[model samples]
Target: MTIGQWYNEAHRALRTASTAMGRSRALAAADINAAVIARSAIYTQLARATALLVGGSPAAEAPDRARATAILARHGQSLTQLYVGLQAAAVVERQFPASPATAVAGPARSLRRAVDAVGVIGDILASHVPPGQTPRTPEGLAVRAGGGVQSGLADIARLTSAAIMIDIALPGWLDQRRGHLTEIYRPAAEAARWTANSRLSAVARELIALGRGQPRLHGLDVARPPLNPAPPVSTADDAVAAVSAARTWMWQNPSELTSVHLQLGTQLGLAVHVLSSTGDPTMIGGWRQAAIAAADLRATSPVGPARDTAAELTEVLRWLRSIGKGNHGEPAGRHLQQVSRLNSELPIMAATLHKGLSAALQRRDLFVKDEGVLQRPAGSLVFRAAERWRPAMRDDDVVQDLVRALVQGQDADSRSEHRSPSSRAFPLPPRPRTPVSGAHWAGFDPPSGPAVRRSR
Candidate 1:
């Protein structure tokens, strides 16, 4: 049976035993049986948990087991509770003085307390089960305690011939949270870093440190090799969202351009493109929405910078969508050109962004001012954010290939439509509004580069 089914059945048995207090001998006997089922079922789960944590039989993967072991060895005191619970349960079975309905309530209560201890340990270990391995904790993950409601988790440490065994480990809520693997934590981390906002960066680091087994949310030391990638917990979509935010900021302050801002935008765009190509749902979900949001945020803003930024981002999003879907006809050629241009410039912008981030790390010039992390130089936050979006101009040949393939696919589709001939009756697509290119090395470039340090 599935582990869930097994767990449910066992839980029902415990509930039956716990509530059996009618003064009859029959009710007392039934309670004992129910308690036995509960104990056996839970002990089984505990065994499975130990196997998972210590890498015992059934799917002995080395790395995961080792990691689990280290976590347990370093901070696993929950086992003591498990042992105490088992001892309590053994006492319940060894003496049935309270087996009569008149005394059943007291016995049931003791049985429940022991069961609860084991259950909590189960949950604690569950929390640490690598998010990837939770699907396999049932099946042979079975065992039981005698009489009713519980068993000794001590079975894991057999005692015989004067030899005591305590090899396996199971983690409990030992120290503070050493690490975490969750859905939202990763994206939150990436967004924190790219903004360079002292607050966000600090939050991101805490999340990063959690993965490395430091749960206090403090140590996000970005190592100097290969660009400390957004923490592994981070999905590609988080990275996309980060870029989209950067792009929107640029749109709001087109007049302000800096190497960091420009390079960031370019790299963000490139990261999105590369990630989308992978088709992994986590990386691709909500991507188109992110593009649309960047445009909408700007479109609703004020007159000069707001509307202007809106217009620019809207055009970029439009191009991104059209290219992705392989939209055809006259616009296809221009879209191809835009894609080609962005591609060529991608590398130069990437190099610039890398250099900027590296320099920021070395110079210790990340965003933050007043003694409190919240305090910053007047207007620097927005000004800095705006500058981060306008990347230097360049081109890429890889995009040319992607665009060419798309154009070819569009061509094939056009032929398919023409051969059918019902296509002419359809309304023509609206002409695209010209993109309001950002002010950079391109046109209205502003004071940028190395000045963020002075802000610090």
Candidate 2:
């Protein structure tokens, strides 16, 4: 079923539970059985929705996917609390048979409130569902629901605490439910951080190499080194700090260097902004400042290689800024944006550097000939070095491949947009098929389905 369908089913089941719990008196055996069946139905639908949302299949847009996952989490937690309240009610009926009326009132009241809380969550989910979809609810129903559900949840919390006083085991069940959600989201979070750090470290190393090599080749005396050794990167924050430090180093120790060096510094600064500014509006100012700095550098640079390099840098920065302004509403989208920028800009930067280095080497070789030197040609050494660094900077196909993989995982429709026509002519290798068993589902383990495989 589509995620929308599953969510609809969950809402229907929640309504059934609410109806069954309408009576203020203690729940009879039939009422309890109905509630249990409804709970099981809701659980199944919620699990299906979550699996579909996070699975390999292309689902909704990134913003919709994020909202759907949050709805699933909130409803799942509410369902758990509802079931706990039901169980506590049953315990109260069994423990105080003499005054069952008063004993069950507290639990029944809490169960009713819990059902209302679940209804409120369903309203929120319904708000995001597209119009004309099956099993739709009134649009903007959540706002009309008075937004008091948060306070209702606090009341439920107090009631659950009272139940806890009566049933010592209640906390264990709540903890188990919380732990299930933690386990599901933790791996995805860690994987995202690891991917960001890896990309950041790679770019930092490239920039450092360019900074050190360019000055020596041009025979320019350095006032200060362009960059120090890259700091150890164990986290995304550490990677950001390292990239920021590189930018600071470049700015603090300004020297006469090639336009390629300036381009690399501009790219590095932009990378810092993209990595660190996931959702912050203030970071846009920093990104614009970096662009302005590059423009200023370009204005002062001489004609020839410097002018050409600055022009390329300007185009790259403009493209990157356009991407930054796009509707990348999630952190995953921001990461993919970073990858896309790198894949597009790296080859141009490398070519510019290679051209400048080659020209410098040719000039040196001519000077050597005019002086009647008997040493080996400088072209040999420079070409050898170029050959080594050329593949690292020029061969951007590896980065393209990474971007393809990431786009596949995040948004499959964007794959075509990331690749050029020539690159698209060559297909990527097929990925291995892996079975997604019930064990892989985050909160609830539903029945297993067919294996999922990804290919280009």
Candidate 3:
């Protein structure tokens, strides 16, 4: 038979097998690996056929040459589809590491990488030939073939190399995260229950010392200052001390405070203390501490950044619970509600903050009065408070937002002291809008049955 005809037959077999595999027929998977093997063998034959055809072999006598070339092209397309299926399957498999043995052993699952590499080579080979030209040499004269095989080999090598890199990197990361989830964090959480009731002051001191070496765990120190201190201290210094301690503790032993409750308690406790201090910088720092504290709470929560921030705002609610409208008036209510609104809108606020920060950096201007504030200036403030800051940008954003809320909340509290109820009720400026989908064809009306009156 002619080379083209043989390739056609091979192509037909592969197509049928692929269809069966798609339907997830057991018979197809059972023998799918064998089908790929057979397909690979046919590809080798096709390569040989092309070589023979290029060597001026007779059209009728050396039909295998023509058949191999055509078959290789068809097979290349089929294997491309096979590679796609394998990649999709791999993605599923990644999500379910303990998949059934049959899944692990299936042809689409196992030979996916190999099929993809080989398929890439086949595509290169297929493209080299002209559509109607007999793969056999013209006029029975032989010609030397070069580049086609080399190009295919190069493509196969590159794809195979990339596949190997993905295989190596993905598993290592997953294994590490799994180990943390299964072995480290889970056990620590169980142990934390026993430690929660320990002397808040003593625990605070040890956590502070532990935090000194690690700046991020600043909030964990339980000796954190009181929510509101008297005239002598100003409360802001105490808040800074609490933030410092908590930041250090959380940074070093983030594993300890895995739940939202712990995160909020740590943050608000620090905020209240910082707000009590007399110093301006310390008071401002208290605001930052509040924001950071809230962020830390969110970062540790199970609901991801969006829900975690909302959950973290429960700390603000806790703080409010302690001192309701005591001479602060409805302005306090408005401010608290604003904070609640921010907490509810954490995800969007977080995004806006990021964009604003980026814009500020680009504009080459400072948003705050102190350049040192923008620079993350150091002090015993965080060192003496609770713990150090947590790792990751999401954590920072949460803390920053809490700080903003505290600062703004205080401003609202002070401003409400002077403004009457009527002035405060006018709707505040609207926040930036978030994107949501709308129907493109919502307002469109379909044309009538026929343009009957068009022609006069």
Candidate 4:
């Protein structure tokens, strides 16, 4: 072949190789997204299935899949929001056919919608952040300005893993609803974590490289995480003491309770994780028992208002107790409104536990001799847990800004008509229509005062 022909062939080959590499990366990105979507679908389905089994109707016709795609394209979107929306839908769906233990269902949905709307708006506004605003990676995504690289990735890794485990084991978990989730899902969850890690491989690498000021970064980089990771369970008595202080702070700031509860649930979850990692039969058994108790508490029918938070707090408390209560810590937080049966006794109980845990560390140990004593290793766990346990609640300034921004951002701000989903710029699942009351079904007023009532 002539030199001209050879030169053309080499150029074409180089182009082909470059295109192939880009194609591979694109495919990996797609796979990560697919995994997330798959997980969300399973979550949504499980909720629907559970609702059906419990005599609840489907929340809303699952939006036409094609239509949903079109809607998503027209509006700004995020994987996290989409997943969260599906989760919210499933949770709301499950909460319907309200049992004795749930919140008074009717009026609360608007609040939930508003919360979701705020979250979605956060994603949307985040998208609009000017490129010049913050330090952007080569791929042009913001980095979490704060913490250790592994922590953020680890958060995604752990959360994604936990979700995957739940998705995988959900059917079984429901089928044997009485079984402890720790028993049913823990092992599978640990394994699923690696799977989540694998999915996040690309994102994690980008984060690491960025932290090190590497020149190479890509278009698909995830957003920067906060400086500190989401808090974990405190293992130290001192750390536990800090948690108590945080609770006291939260109590004074009642508005912060919801965030506290979310944090507590997370800490309790992480505590179980740390405990389980120890692998001792006793610790594992404690974790299992705690898990079972938690599952049982939440499984009770009629998970009314405080009962939900109560159940969650109780789960945390039970685990703490199982671990020998090296430090007195109470499971009080934002989500915990007054638990119904407590008759406002929870604070007293917490105070009492606080006093009990304050005693000599060895004395607190029901464990043999020094066996229960939290030594250097336990100290690290405690400090890490305490540091991580601090709630990321931004109730006042953060929430206010978000609410104002979303409202002002609405296309329907001036319109009297109700806003459509598209106007909000998020793809939140439809709120379930309120179940009509019996009075509405009868379509007639009951006899009123002065016995001027209708004849029976």
Tens digit of per-residue lDDT, candidate 4, span 143-178: 222212222223222223334433343233223233
Give stretches of model 2 more than 4 Å off. 1-34, 53-456
Backbone clashes under 3 angstroms, per model: 19, 0, 65, 20
Candidate order by lDDT, decreasing, is 3, 2, 1, 4
Off by over 4 Å in 4: 1-144, 148-150, 172-456
TM-scores of all candidate predictions against the true structure: 0.21, 0.17, 0.16, 0.18
What does the lDDT come to for candidate 4?
A: 0.28
Q: Write the per-residue lDDT of candidate 1 for residues 147-196, one digit (tens) a residue.
A: 10111122222210001100010011011133432221233222212222
What's model 3's TM-score? 0.16
Per-residue lDDT, model 3, residue 177, is: 35
lDDT of 2 at 410: 19
Give each model's whole-structure lDDT. Answer: 0.29, 0.29, 0.30, 0.28
Best by TM-score: 1
Candidate 4 — number of clashing residue pairs? 20
